[model samples]
Target: MIAAIALAFSFLTATAQAKVLELHRGVGVHEWLNWSPVNEDGTYIWPPYRAEQEWLDSFRKGTVSKGENEFQRIRSMGFDFVRLSVDPGPLVSSEGTKRKEALAILSKAVKRITASGLRVVFDLHGVNQVPATSMKLIYDGADSEGVARYRAMVKEVAGMLVKVGTDKVAIEPYNEPAYYPCDASGTDDWQRIMEATVADIRSVSGDLTIIATGACGGGVKGLLNLKPGFDDPNIYYSFHMYEPHDFTHQRSETKGGFASGMPWPASTSTPEAVRKALEARIDAAGLSRAEKRANLAEADPLIAKYFAENWGEKQLDARFEQALGWAKTNAIPSERLFMGEFGAILMTADGRMGADDADRIRYLTAVRRSAEKAGIPWSIWEYANTYGMSVIVPKENAVPDMNMLGALGLMRQ
Candidate 1:
């Protein structure tokens, strides 16, 4: 009887000690299973143009005999985990055999990451490939049917991943939900959708961790808007960090224009100097005279606002307080909150629009350390792709920017 009692106690103790997921520093793995272009009918372009199989094969077959695969390289770079983003549109668009095959590919992909010795936060990142089955359907007040279909998809995927092992993967149902104005004035539809997302995954496995997010593009304000009344014990709240979006995303296809050479903390340089440099670049863009004038007109105010904000470590700390404060308010521990994604673009050596490498390092270090100081775990924006913010100098190569590594404290300065 004593031996049996001791065995039971051992089981209980191990159960109590086991974490749903243990993460310190992580990085996003994108453009592999995610962001694939879809057909007109919302179906995933078969044999995705992004080369999913070839990418996986690259990880399986190392450059050298008994060489390190990409995932192994990620582990060597000091990342404890990877938030593997997946474009779920294919599952939504396909049926029967096709759906099962798509899911199999995803499961194999997860196994590939673990084989290389990295944990995963399986992220369901949405894209605007098609309104019917895209990121927009769930958040923009779609019909109940659309919402139900999305919930079902999450449940199916979550169930499949947990079978691979609860310890290896967590389900993040959505990314950067765009239910704007995150306040009383905003739509509460996201509230219901977010709840259903958790409920769907919860229905799959009680032990599988769920990554919950707020509405407005997963920022701190968005997290503050959520009211998590969950009965489950395993969950991590997530929010993306790019507070001064204009600065971090500057010169990307989105918000910011072609404003390069800007510094972090804004106070590093005067607005006058920044404006002069920006105007010259705008002129050198070789647009028509009228276009140059228009570009300058568009660039001036954003520059003034960026300088006026004077973003630095202190301001970033204050911004982070909002999330930590929210956690405290909800009686949630700081350790349970996650900086799901944060990164600044790296300007290309060829002068394509991006932030300077030095500036990027400073911003990355400041944000990364601030999150650490707050006792929060963070994952940088991505592992690859020439999307401006990758740690790899060239998207195609396995080279790590030693400076970026130092900035993240992953390598010795």
Candidate 2:
């Protein structure tokens, strides 16, 4: 049955090739989980927060219609796929009544997206946000019981997707595994979690592609100490890049919050600066030096081990080379590797909340050029958001820079 499904999907993909179903050339539409498509009291509610239940109602009602329309707009702009932020917590309500309602809303959204001929990657963004000790039935800690629960969650989601016939759905098990620091040795238990999660999912849906995130959303270094037995064909190693977070998260004086008025040195973006900073931090922290050195020593052949990896081209060029070298030494194929997420901030020299559109374009162009030269596929950081390549203003106005998106290969024309 699994073979048959794979064959059918393969055929569908092949036939759809003329439509340019380029997975590597995709862009993410971040904050989909909090986004709503409805207006309240003459104001549009975007980035709907959890506390705003009324706004959520309006948003849910509008999302099926509005979400589809937005996706259509994206597709029209020449994008072939979207990375959706999906939280299964809402779908699995504590109360029976709420569970049904949540499922209905999600089903509607999924149906609309699939019908539009666009592939969707269901990212489990906030599993641990729930009150339960065990989220998605996967154990947060190494305890036996937690592991059991985590497995249960994985099986449940896999079974649900199978029933829905959402063949294009790719599961991102956890959003950012390295958000919390691990041991001093830099030993994160991701391999254990991935192994168990993959086993559960494969049990239910034999061929579901699973995208595995690295620790702290960094690159291949996080996966170095992973136990050897966990590798699987269906697994796609994934990572997220929001480099020199100071740059990406910088905000203006008027925008008062965590990101406001933060200063990031311009030198940090340079290759030498990044290498120095990374080396210094690694040395100071007394973490993972031996493993990193060993990996770099054998870097030539390990490049093919990863299915996809994300990084900022300018900020982490040395790290990228190290990773690629390892893959090459390990005899890993280039096609299996990819740059999953990357983009520059739209900022000016003075660090205000405005678009330095040319710099953004240049950054993307350089990344794309480098990836193409390396024979690696890539997905730009975003679409239809301020941080993304395009900005989705309130109401119907989507201020899209066709040239920028075009440069990133997100927009064909």
Candidate 3:
């Protein structure tokens, strides 16, 4: 009798543990992830390439590894998710041989990631024969025909994922929608595109999560104003947060030209500065007095739109709150809101090569903490080179400040 009781207890304990593990194993309904490319040489190549012949040849020849090693390093750094870029053209080929090859590569990657206990987000980074500028389907006079072509391509990709039973894989319709231009009229057209794309994906697999990029890549205001389609729980909103691009793309030695030694946009540090800058620009443009006054009033509310009074040491906390409020107002649950891209570029006061590691840590730490507080998921801008957080081919061998990671409560040690 005693032996039997002990055996029963052990079996129940094991079953309970298994259930707990299973709950955590699948792609999370709400969680954070990091984005990066898987280069052939296992190192993430910085500054993602457009579909140029020279770039393609170099990438294929292993001259540019999209940082596979860096991805592993990111995993080691404690990230449980990854967003991989798939050039839609290559993945969806008219030639059966090319399509098979692409599928094989993707399948291998999915298996590898699953084995490593990570979830995957497949981003249709670029479409074939289409330049990056015109890749998105949302812009005015956008190749409507091209948009249809890419929609078909996405359906094909979604079909493959469904067939493979890879539930962890989600699809991002396009990488960055606002890299081109989309006015109010274009925005309406893009909504139709989004509705169509979502329907196509659902036709293949209703379970797949469809990530839609917002205007200006889902800016907070745009997201709040959006009225998503009817009863699509599988859809989510994504927005890139590389605000004040002038700071993020400061001059570098290798990529010469443009302004050299320009400082990070001062406006980002405070809302008042941002408002003042906007006012000055409107005034300088020589708008009619009435127009200028209207513009100023219109912009005034935006200054305090997403801020908190007691933001404290966490400045990003206010920003996150503002963004979350926008999402909530739009009927988007916290789970559906994500910080799709955000990272600080390292730049010296004199505009030199090495970045300010301390500042980078502070910025990232604030953002991470804010996301946790807001109950919103987030992904770092990148896992490697371009933004200076290259884990595999770091710009310098300097040891990471473990304390900084700890400050963000990311590193246990």
Give one digit per residue, the lDDT tens place, for model 3 in 73-109. Answer: 4456666666666655444333366556556656665
Per TM-score, what order, best first?
A: 1, 2, 3
Q: Model 2, range 262-325, lDDT digits (tens) per residue?
A: 1222322443433343344334445476643543333212221111132245445665565567
What RMSD does each model have against the real structure?
4.8, 12.0, 12.2
List candidate 1 segments past 4 Å from native: 1-18, 37-42, 45-53, 56-67, 140-143, 252-257, 282-289, 350-352, 395-397
Candidate 1 lDDT over 190-271, as tens digits, reads 8888887776675556678888999888999999999987624478899889978877877734333455667887888888
* TM-score, model 3 to reference: 0.63
* Whole-model Cα lDDT of every candidate shown, in order: 0.78, 0.51, 0.51
Error of 1 at 134 (Å): 0.6
Candidate 1 Cα deviation (angstroms), residue 14: 12
Judging by TM-score, tell me the better candidate of 1 and 2. Answer: 1
Instruction: Tell me the lDDT of model 1 at 190.
Output: 85
Best by TM-score: 1
- For all candidates, the clash counts are 0, 24, 9
